[model samples]
Structure formats: C-alpha cells, structure tokens
Target: QIIEAIESAFGDGPLSGRHVIVTSGPTHEPIDPVRYIANRSSGRQGAEIARALRDLGARVTFVTGPSTTPPPAGVEVVAVETALQMLGAVQGALPADAVICAAAVADWRVANAHADKLKKDPSGRIPTLEFVENPDILATISQMQEDRPRLVVGFAAETSDVLAHARAKRARKGCDWIVANDVSPETGIMGGNENAVLLITADGVEQWPRMEKSEVARRLARRIAEALAE
Candidate 1:
C-alpha cells in the first residue's frame, strides 16, 4: 500500500528506464537424494524488494533459490536450487542497472554429493564430509568486464560487530553497498517478519529503525530508483 502510494505520487518513469536484478532465498547444497545443506532464509525480504521495485516501474529479474514463496507479480522470476545454478542465472540476467544480493547463499557445498542416503553404521564411525567454497555471485558480477550493474548491494548476516563485518564484506566482494543485520540466535531475524538493519555504502552508514520487511523493501527500492536516476 505504501509502495503504491509512492508510485502514484511519483507518476510514471520513476524506474521505467532501469533494469534490476534481485537474488533471494537459500541455495540448497545437495548432500543426498533425501537431504541437503540449506539455510533458514524464507525469502520474504527479497520477494518484497522485488515487488517494490516492480511497483516503482523497474524491469526486475528475480532469481530465487530453493524456496516455497511465490514470485512477486510483474517481475520475471527464475528459480534454481544449488548455488552454482543461482550463479549461472544471475550471470545470464545481465545489463541490470542494479543488483541486490539478498540470497543467503551457502558459503560451502559438499565436495562430493552422495547419490544415495547413507545408512547408520553399526561400527559407529562417522562418514567424512568434505566441503568446498561456493561461487560468490555478487563478487563475480561486481567485477565483471562489461555490463556490470551500476550499483551492487549485498546483505551481510552477522552475529557481532555487524557494521565492521559489513564493511569488510563490501570491500571483499567489491560491491557498492551492503545491508548489515544481526542474526544472532535470539534475534530470529533470519526468517522473521521484521528486522533492524543498517544500510552501508561508500558514503557512510545509515541506521534504520526496526520495521517490517515489506516496509524496508519499499524504502530500499525507492532509494534504488532514485540512485539510478542520479
């Protein structure tokens, strides 16, 4: 409703000239046919941002990982399961004016995925599970040779020193901006309805008041639209 009001006030052409890319949900790293390594992301925040961007008139390409939520209306949605698949999808959805890395991508994947479920061993020896680093989608796109988005925003889920960690993430990933949040066990922010976040950029940091994820998305989308216009 708020987004609708903002769109009406701005009239047309606010974001019509731009293309935005958003990544959402948690990528599942297959461990076996019956199980996988995944995160607690529900994709509510990412979907809201995609919807808000579309409402603002931007052409949005929303890439999602394994999730139960549906894509927002009026946006092109691409679904994938593994981190590798999400990376490929993001790469294919290029020429975007902005890219929002909202997905809780697994940092590592099983080095060797099992084709079948392993049974419990009577000998009581645990099976060794090797892991390998997954591709950093945001970093790859940010450092692209050409057709890179003008602005790249990533999310840093941390427990302590959130702002400091976010700064390091921005520098490490070569992204233009990052949204930092504390996802401590007590916060329940990972898959919750509301959040308190800090928007960090090269210019400075902006601490946002606690609000519903939808509200945050709407505001962020508006900011993104304005930035593209600049």
Candidate 2:
C-alpha cells in the first residue's frame, strides 16, 4: 500500500495514478516450420501512442507482436507472436484505466501446424491447409464483466465504407471507441507515415485531418486525459 501510494504520488502528471495498455503490430500465425500468416501493420501508431500515454504520466504496458519498429522507451513491453499470446499478455496487464487494441491480428491460424516442413511431392500435389479462427482479443476484453477498463479503444482498418464498418465494429466489440482509417492502396495510409482517422464513439464520429502518426498519438492521448478527468 505504501509503495503504491509513493509510486502514484511521484508519478506527478495529468495521468498520474493511471495505467494504460496498448497492443500493437500484427500477429504471426504459423503455417509450418518455415511459413506463417501475418499482416502489414507497421506498429508505428501504437508505439507512438504508448509514448504519448507515458508522457502524460501513465504507467503504460505495451503488448506487441513482431513489429519491425522498436517498442517505446519507459514502458513495460510484452513481446508476442500469436494472437493467443498477445491476449494472455493483455489479460495479465489488466485492471488498467484504459485499453487500446491496435494490433492487426490474423483472423485464423493453422489448425494442424506441422512439426516438420513437408517435402514437395513428386506428383506435384499441393498440401491442403486447414485453419481455425483466432480469439477476438478486443471483444473479449471489452465485454469482460470483471476488471474491465473504464475506456476500451479499438482500431478498424478498412478499404471501403470506413466509418460504417467502424461503427459496426464498435457495437459488435462493445468497446468505447473505434479509430477507423482507410488502408486503400491509393491512400498510402497502411505501412506509411501519416494517417487520417475517424474517432467513433457513442456520442458521434469525429473526422481528423491527415497528419503524422505521432501527432495522432499525441492528440488521442490528450483526449484520453480529458475523458478520464471527466
């Protein structure tokens, strides 16, 4: 109790005494000893968000996948590869003030991962791959009855009808907000530097101008601070 009090007092910022968890990057679902299914998420935005939350004096726990971008400094980093592992990490860091699910988790994983790489057949027959759905981490956490965060945020990367999809996602996932963005090839938003996002909440949707991912992180962090204050 004394340690907790001292830590909270010394935190000394707008978000002091608050804990935030952010998940970033794409999960790799193994297909074989050498192959895996993954996505193109750069994890830049999530890393920036973690930094922004930390700057606001929040104790940040960053649960991440195999991202090329380095994890942010001054935060507890839990590195994971599969969706299940990521979910476990997030659950372990729970009882947080806020939770952000920014990861591009693979929808399915190999139902029967091979222990060894299969050799090519002389008859040119291809191997049949079976898949199973992965756990919906965002939905699981958002709908938790116990130890649920006050604010739960999710990301919806869409190519068409972004806002509509995001709204449906927020409702389906039961999260407080959804950060929706276009990843259509022309936009160059995915795996790029800048992002234009729509913040969807029960109140309404707010469209943000295209800007650096870091800037978006800062703005979102400020908004989170304001919301938590209220």
Candidate 3:
C-alpha cells in the first residue's frame, strides 16, 4: 500500500499509461423542446470515480450528461445531454484500458418530440408521446469483440433484490463487474453523499459497507488498477 501510494503521488502508479473512460450523470430523453425525462442521479459517485482514477495516474475521459456537479481536474470532460449524444461521445473515446458505465442513461427516449414548447390545452387533453428505446451503452461496449476494454464496469441502481438483480445484470450485459447499489427512497443514496454497494464479479459477490461516495470511488479505482496490472 505504501509503495503504491508513493508511486501514485509521483504519477507513476499501476494505472499510469492506462486510459479509462468513465460515463457519469443522467441522460435526458426529450419529450419536447421544453420538457424531458431524466433519472434522479446527481452524478456524485461517477464524478468521484473519475477523480479517483485520475489520482491513480490514468488518462481519464469523463463523459458526462446533464449534471450540476463539476468534473474533477486532470481529466478530459465531454459534456452531453441526451443518451444518443452520450453514446457518441463514449464511442469516440474508445479503445480504453477500462470503461466504467456509471451514467444513469435513460432506457427510452421520445420518438416524436416536438420542436416547439408543448402548450397546455384549456380543455385538459393530455399530449401523447411516442417512445423508443435508447441505446444500451454498457452492453454495446461490453460485447465488443474487436477492441473490448480489458475491464468493463457497470452500475446497477436497484430498489429491491439488489444482489439478485445485479448478478443477473452482470451476466446479461457481459460486463466484467457490476457495482450494485440500493437507491430506494429510504436509503437516500440517489442524491446523497454516502453509498453501500455490492461488487459482483465472476469470483463472487462482495457487499461493501456504507461509506462516503469518495471512499467507494477510491476503493474501486484501486481494484481497477490491480486488475489492469495483472
């Protein structure tokens, strides 16, 4: 640990010369020019993860969605709004050593969003919206055969059966690991500073204790370094 810390301080850590792509924040699916659909993500965890990776001397490509949280220093930031844009950005920054799909990308988008602001009818008639499924960023990168990253990490934000859902997700997405977290309202994790996550890998599932989001990022970053070193 001490040696690794010193190497990291000198910017020659295990992850030096490695490039990692981290997607953070929540992608918005537009319903109209003035309205959109989004998740309850504050981008806190993702930001911290990017920061941690940077501290380990890796070249970080921070692809982010619409969030107020400022990205960390010593990282390249690609700001995007919708899922499609985010997907493009990630693809453009490809061939990385690792990719962390930490963004809460919307599952669907409006297929026929109006160009102008939607007007409210005095007769109280609701406007209908056509929906289309958004691109599965995690699965796309995870299943890539030509230039797949050495490590692919995805996040599963579940309200119930966290581990079961996470394990299934890892297999389904074909990612190297899954970081599962309970974001049920009572947990206060969605927009909070602390988190409790489950690390699901081929070996087994490891449940992490609740702690500050920053600490979780640090631990995950270290693990990624070790994995890459091997």
lDDT of 2 by residue, 43-86 (tens): 99999999999988899999999999899899999999999999
Query: lDDT of each model, Cα atoms only?
Result: 0.89, 0.91, 0.94
lDDT, model 2: 0.91
lDDT score at residue 92, model 1, on the 0-100 scale? 89
In order, what is each prediction's RMSD in angstroms? 3.1, 4.0, 2.1
lDDT winner between 1 and 2, please give it: 2
Clashing pairs in 1: none
- Model 3, clash count? 0
Q: lDDT tens string, model 3, 208-229?
A: 9999999999999999988887
Q: Which portions of model 2 miss their true places by more than 4 Å?
A: 1-11
Q: Cα deviation of 158 in candidate 2 (Å)?
A: 0.6
Q: What TM-score against the true fold does each predicted structure earn? A: 0.93, 0.94, 0.95
Candidate 3 C-alpha error for residue 190, in Å: 0.9
- Model 2 is weakest, by summed lDDT over 10 consecutive residues, at 1-10
